[model samples]
Target: MEPATPLMNDETETLSRMTPVEAFLATPASNVRSETPQDPEHQYLWRCFPDHVWSQRVRDTSSWVWDFGYDIQNLNGSRRWVCKRCIQNKSPRPRSFAEKGIQNANAHLFKGHGIWAPAEATKSAAQRKAEKMKTKDQRSIADVMKLDTRLPREQEIANSLVKSFDRKHFQRLLLEWIIEENHSFSICEQGRLRQIFEYLNPLVKITDASITRKTIRHRILSAYESHKGKVIAALKQSSGLIHVSFDGWKSGNRHSLYGIACFFRDENSQPRKLVLGVPELRTRHFGHNIAAEILDVLDAYGIQDRIGYFTLDNTESNNKAMEVIGGELGFVGSTRRGRCFGHTLNLSAKALLFGHNVEAFEEQRSDQLTYLLRSIQRSEFEMSSDPRIKARKPLDLIIDNDTRWLSQLYMIRRALTLRPFVEQLVLKHRQQWEQDNRSRRTGNLRKSAKEPQICLEENQLTTNDWDVLDHLARLLGFYEDAVKTLEGDGQQRRRKRGWVGSYGNVWEVIQGFEFLLEVLEDYKKLASEIPDAEHFRININLGWEKLNKYYSRLDETPIYYTALALHPAFRWGYFENEWKDNAEWVTKAKQMVREVWEREYRHLQIVRNSVADEPVAKRQRKYYNPFQAYCERTRTVSGCIVVGGWGQ
Candidate 1:
């Protein structure tokens, strides 16, 4: 290959010595050898390189002719030798075409980018169109006074409407027409007219649907009451014994009032509840007035001399009322007064033991016990595995302090059952008290003089306090006897070294038992001396027996044992049922009583098994062996089992 000639141009010579296209083609890939031109004004320069020869055309080609021997003049004038290989290898130059012009470019960009614009523009355009469509006429006829011109005519129309629908006159005319024609009228039809007139007429306010129904019913009832003679004639055909139970108490607001509930045994011997009466007795004068009001009510019900019994709480006013009625009515033989046993027991217990002082003492004790029990229960819950405080629920330890003396008895019973846990709590309490006392003493060592007395008054027992304690003691005694009576024959069989019956407790049982015995003796004396009034006097001996059975039966269950111990009526019902059967004037009465007693005795045995430990069981076995031996020793006595042969 010949030495390559460098291609040059005016701009290329001034700047980096090569034009951009020339530098690109001349580097290595373009192989140019010589220059030629196919057009008159242009020339092609061919330069040979290692890979290929690139050709470029030059414009001026007149004077200089090199020894390569090509005719420059001939090549310059539209006839030239071209590097056909270079021309074939080179890519075609891109044509300079007009893109979008500046304004067109911007418009095209804006249109392509406007995705949200159509939605926004359409919304705004629609709003503007709607605003334009809502134009109103400012000088319309509505602006003129149509109301002022038509007021008198409208008033006349309203007056005509009201006159045409005169409700009161219409009702009266309808009633007269019905009476004259002897025709029945439907309330549903007639009542709708009243409703419509009330709704439309401006002067009348419509009654609510509920109020309208109530008023119509009241009117109908009033019409029926005008014919009261018919009601009395019907009542006379169905007469039976009337039962009245009355109770009186002072309310929380300090109002002394009496509540009377009347019931009656119908001809079928079934009890029916009647009207309950509440008469306001303002003064002593009103007492008689109250009585008269009660009598009037009874008479209205057509009750004459068929009253069986009047049950009332033991109140002086109630007794006086009974006396007044019996004397005035000349039906003294028909009226019988009986005191309610439940109310009497409640009142008697409250009057004796559950007075203010005793109650306050109980409250204090209960609070302290509750705090201690809760603390122990919490500790037990935390130490899940601790056997000493084994996770007993706090409710199981909670003492019910609402009742009079019963709650205390319940607490005592619980203490006996949970003696180990309770003992721990008592010890903890003693330690806390001792620590407090020691702290007080330590404080005293720092002071030179003794503390001054806060007041001159020394605490003295009030009569009320003494009375309360006495009453509580009496009730405690009753409970003690009840416990003893229940364990009568069973005690010897079940007695162990440390075991205590309900009456053998350290606090209340010993003294209470002695007191109960004395009370029983007094009751026996009273019953014998006043045989006529024996039924009137309260018999607590029977009450004790009933309570014992209840508590003994309760021993079988963990939850109710303490409750049964405290409640004196658990087995009272059973005893009463048995007693009633025994007293019945029937051939099978004795057999019935025996059956009840046997069932109850079996239940008691079950409870005893549940409560008794090994020692108790051993003692029970030993004691019962003799009874069994005695039974075997003799034949039956008087058609009953002979134990030690009591029957002659």
Candidate 2:
């Protein structure tokens, strides 16, 4: 059937004489081509038609169509409309009044398009089809508006669906929030949060059923369990050896927390470091207790047998802990226990900075100055209230806190900066004492024995003393750089390994040890240039001796040399050059590398066992050349190339 004909101006004039359906059927289609593209603000009536037909309908047709199903009356020459037949369509006859103005025009447009149905409504297929057409027309007019407010409201309703709630999403958000800001559980307990959530979205309930700290924690634990499975699977897939590191600290509550972290290359050859656990130690901090804790964590994750190197600080306790673990896990060989090179460097520097009875000297100086200042004050040269004395000077001498790392460096640097102010304090005390005491009568003001003053000469920091402090500071700078280079992050190491964390493997540690000795030997010659060089010379010698002891320990551990030799670019060539001066040591290193292969390579062991019945000399020859054949085989089978040479 043809679409209804449009009502002309004559028909509109005769509308009172006709039925509402007749008026609507006779209404003309719009000739409403936008002078500009339709303005969404003014296209309230245009939305009843689909885009294919919107421009073909009349602007007033919307009013005629509304009158078909609703009662529209003129109130003070303005239209007032109500859907009297709302119940007939099986839609809610809302007691609420809908403005006959543009405030709710988009909603009416949406309803007319059949894209949206009210919660209470059911309609015929024909009515739904007509509604869809009208809805398309409405959207064409809305396209030009800067903002379409309806989209968000509709999305909000969709997102707030209870059955659609995602536990994973909540956990992800909670984890991100905790990591970024360290928020506590109290954020969930706030009453205003509920109110704020309600204001933002009433449909999404934030009651105990949905979001609580306990639920957040549960979700996080669930995610942790899932991640643990993935990590274990990845570890099993990768052939690379796993490195374990321990960093322990005591909380303010005196509870010991041991942080165990692991590093390994994944199947795709990406380097990854995952923190395994940080369990609090409630038992007595004995070697066995610490070792048991570490074993439990590793066994729980099923990676106890996979560990290649266990890196830890060089502490007596750690030494004991390693021994205990070695006994239980059969990590008897030297290569299994890896001492932190960074920690060794720290110890060497600490010995020089603090091992010279420096604390006693500092205390003596402090006591002498205190007594002299008090004596001068009692003699009537009172300068305590003086503005000049009260003014800020370079920070006062900061006593070294032995427990803190690098505290010696800070103390020395701060003392040097405040040297001028300290000298001034001493001079004022000395000069004032002379002037005040000279004017006193035969009988002097008596002071207690506890307050006895010492001569300025005894407490003074001479030119030679200042030279010692300056030289010490210069010496510390070398170790500071070494520590930072050895302990820096992997990203920096990737860019320039020598200046970053180069001590990740054994060969680098040996190289660093050799470098320190050479530098110390050279420094001894240079030390003669400074006054009081003997103190530093002795300390340097001590550090060299300590470093040498650890350097010798590397001989027993072949993996250090093994890791270096495995790199295709280096092979045995690097070690040959490094130890060329010591021919005996070089031969020993080569032999140890061969021995490590016989002990660790599973396939090589199988081959050795198979050929055991052969002649002894022939077997020895075959084993002697095992590394070269192994390297060649590895290259052929895996197609793995050395991306870079051994890090300097």
Candidate 3:
């Protein structure tokens, strides 16, 4: 490409060539004055050259001119010049010196920057020698490996390195590092990390000592105190009657009686179970005194006024206690007292078997059966490994002292079911006992010597004991009859098949047995005419009457009646056996009950509604303002108010 011409020869030359006297008229139409050339070609060339070629040339010359004071330009159709003085003053432009300084200063930072370094003789002899010395001073990977290989010889070094770190301290350090690096950790993440550290670190043990427990307890107390304000606020917002269920039970040691009060909302939409009170009952206190102490607990929880009913197991002391409380609270009749269903069932069972000679027999048979079974168990254990005898412990062995009688009954029933096994056990024990007696007489010690000595005395199996066993068998048969009766009596097969009828049978069986006991007591004289003879039965008719009266009264109670009506075991028969027999009477009774309940409920509602509306109605008076009423109630005498002004 041909060299381009200069747009301007020089600043001085261009200025001198211009006519100074001519008016310098600058207009948007033309960039030049009238005296200067305004050719379209020249104007276009000037604009293009300045934007493209002239701008590039100026940029290229700027660094050398500004820094080194040297400038050079092309010499062709365009006039250009170079400054020799500027070039000479630049001192060889310092290319080699600047490069060497930068490389040396950045050596540590840039050593690994390049993909590869030149292997040519670019370095001076002194630089090469210095580099060699630096490499010699530094340890190589092979040298370090050799040094590590010598570590086994230093016992002290190994001991120092093996010193165990305190896990908690290390964990703290790690947490601090994490916090320092990340600024903050979320509560959940912090807890997770804490658990992880606790699991992994041996030295950071979780202390559950008494001191820790006390500390936790104190913290909980503090939290509860903090929440007390909120709890009170919630209580104020809630409306309705609060019902409380209070129960007291003696602890295993009987040293203290603990009372638990559960609060709940009643059918009238009231909150309950808000407070639980526990008080220690002294052993010296009477039943009435214990009841008073319970009242004291109620007072402490601010629950005395809210209590509507008290449910308890059937105990004389409890009933007396309830009587005392009722008198104090002015609650008449049975309004404040209710009996537990579980306790009533037990009482019913006791009542049904009243005046029975079966109880003594049951006790005797139970004792005999226990004695026999335990002897067999001991013998079985001793001869368990004997090759000739396949010894096994009876599944129905009675071990618990408290339930021994029940266990005896269970074992007898089981023996009846597994007749072969029981027969085997009995025969085995009998044979072992015979062998033991023979050995004892002969003065021969046997491996099964730990076995209990069986009593062959005939007096041990008395008439009373046999009578009890026979009665128990009869009771079982009665139970089966009761079940069959229920199954056959119901209107529908499905309904008849339920447990309700059986419960009725259970009640009937108990009453029938009591009646039988009465008959047995009356027929003592006739026992002489019977095949078997025994001791004359003592007249315990008074005891039976008392027992029968106690149970009958219990059955008459409203709570027992309610339970009998509601119990799943009696639901089918309750409407049929009890209510259906007297349907007309029941219908009248139900109508009367409904009328009483409706009247009572309506009266309660009226009272409540009256209480709610009184304040509202009073406030509706012309001069009465609710704000003023509030102020009056709060006893605030002065506040901003408008008087005698309708607009205000």
Candidate 4:
């Protein structure tokens, strides 16, 4: 049964004669009051009774009143005063006065006047029943009336959102929502979403026009066109050179998508990057077609000539695209296509690890290991019934794919971790195979047990092989760091395009190639020193050949040496120290760098007479520009020593 309203009042008063406060405090007790409740504790109503009349301030009647009865005094002070009836019934959401004292009581009296007012002053039972019967639309109108009854900031934000719910804003919001949350367009038509929106904000109505899947698609198309126009406009206005990258990949649905992104520094030198578009390839992705698509995009932005770099993977298709575009752009020679350093490192590592094979040898062993593990699981299940005998989990072997060598690295690492376990597993399989053969000879096993046993010959891992695997894992760890540092997540290309940073610049590659050769040679020497090297013939010379091929190509690219010479830290002196054995190559490198200054940058020079009124020390300022000073020579008198520096 519903609990009785203990403090119900029958007094009646007109709104004009008395306020809600007066009517609320003047309420009388319930008609069927408990006759045994004659004590002061039971009769006390903190909201209605004066504090002074009940007890002294020193005795802390406020604490007793908050606890509903004065029998027990709280050691810790109390703030909110629970309703006497609510406390008695043990309501989870008990009505309580605020910590600020009587302000909450006044608010309660005003807001709850519909139910708390005297019998005659309150709404009639018929009127109350009519309120409960109101439709959702009618209730929504009532909720709209209370929109401005919130905190200032909250109310302002809500009002702004409602006002800005125009077609464009709605389209942009819907597009972002769908893409970011990976939700389908059909979600707009779903009932649960509409219900949730209504429950969250009754005043805001989500109409069919705003939520229909067809309308959402149309809006997305229009928004895309609008955004594309803006991007084109910005690119046309930009003065800085723009670098672009394009890559094609198949999605989960088998759609061929080609994504292109542009990077450049803004007018203030702040880095900025934006995706041009990810257009789907409906037609065949031929070299000419890809070139045409890329040119169309660059031409649309009017930034074809301002293109700084084309960061693409070293693929024949992409190379053809570069060749076709290069003819039109007047960019000749081997430097037309800026090969992605990350991709180059990936290819080099793959060549080193798996030379001619399409897939790594480790992958085949991994498959065999996986199959044997499954067989072991079936064999061990019957013995796993005992709680103490914990079932062994099947080992997860990593697949070594050709494209990503990092997966190969992780596979080798996992192999090292499971080396001991795998060795024991292989031994067990061999013994079980022998035992099955003996049982079959005796003709004691069932026909089902005559299944083909796992051949351990395919799994070519032994204790000796573990040492080689360990070496490979340790060696690949360096390349893994290089790839991560160069590629950086591939999201922030503008920031990662710095010269001296780990982002793998053309100049850094020259140094890295030299360093990598030394590392490989050192490993080769170490391998020769290992005992039983003949048994484990780990040939790393193939890696050296591949690395040297790329290093030789670096000689054809002058920018690499030019960049190294330009850096203040590593000038001609650094090469002298680093490449002492190859003095002729160093001389050729310096000559090529000097030719760059003479060929393209000679027009920037300004001649000055040094004998004017300056002192010997200060005269060095005449040829202060390093590029000019380094390239030009000074003719000093034969008798006098060349007192000043090279510039003087």
By TM-score, the best candidate is: 4
Superposition TM-score, candidate 2 onto the true structure: 0.53
lDDT of each: 0.39, 0.56, 0.39, 0.57
Once model 3 is optimally superposed onto the true structure by TM-score, how far is the C-alpha of residue 161 displaced, in angstroms? 20
* Best of the candidates, lDDT: 4
**Candidate 1 residue spans exceeding 4 A from truth:** 1-239, 284-293, 296-300, 333-335, 346-369, 381-392, 396-426, 434-648
lDDT of the structure predicted as candidate 1: 0.39
Q: What is the TM-score of each candidate against the true structure?
A: 0.32, 0.53, 0.38, 0.57
lDDT of 2: 0.56
TM-score of 3: 0.38
Over 497-516, each residue of candidate 4 has an lDDT whose tens digit, in order, gives 23222233445556566656
lDDT of 2 by residue, 524-547 (tens): 787788766677778777777777
Task: Provide the lDDT at 624 for model 1.
Answer: 31
lDDT order, best first, reads: 4, 2, 3, 1
What ranking emerges by TM-score with the best candidate at the front? 4, 2, 3, 1
What is the C-alpha lDDT profile of model 3 across 265-366, one tens digit per residue?
Answer: 334333334444455665554668767777766654555555555656566677777778767766542544655433443333233333344355332234
Error of 4 at 382 (Å): 19
**Between prediction 1 and prediction 2, which has the larger lDDT?**
2
